[model samples]
Target: MSLWYFLIDWFAGVPTFGVLFKRFMINFAWVCIALFVMLVFQLPAEYAAIVYFGFIVVNGVMGFVFLRQRMQMRD
Candidate 1:
């Protein structure tokens, strides 16, 4: 299997903290992408705030949906 898939499986299999770890990693990746975009575009402070807020909202919603799906699959 690919290393990426293996890492994901490893993270998911962690005792007690797998879900939290996955969510954190997802958020961290989104932050990195957002920062890269902001740096490349050199957004103004106002727009940067908007972008950051949007990314946070998106990340939270995506995380929620992911958890919900996982829960459904477990039942």
Candidate 2:
């Protein structure tokens, strides 16, 4: 496998920290995508801010759901 994939898989398998690490990476990806869209479309400052806020809220909800599912699966 590629080095990047190997590293990601290794980190993801780590006991407790792995979950947090994966969540952080997912959130970071969302932020990066939002920034890319804003820059590429040349959105106004107000619109960009709103888009960023929406992405954050969506990420939070997704993370919560993911964690909840993980907990349910563990039971």
| Decoy 1 TM-score against native | 0.47
Residue-level lDDT of model 1, residues 9-73, one tens digit each, is 64444333466557667767877788778889987778768767876775566556566767876
C-alpha RMSD by candidate, in order: 5.9, 6.5
Q: What TM-scores do the predictions have?
A: 0.47, 0.47
Off by over 4 Å in 1: 1-42
TM-score of 2: 0.47
Tens-place lDDT per residue, model 2, 12-51, is: 3434546766766776787789878888998788877886
C-alpha-based local distance difference test score of model 2: 0.68
> CA lDDT of each candidate?
0.67, 0.68
Question: Any idea what lDDT model 1 has?
Answer: 0.67
The residue ranges of model 2 lying beyond 4 angstroms of the native Cα positions read 1-37, 40-42
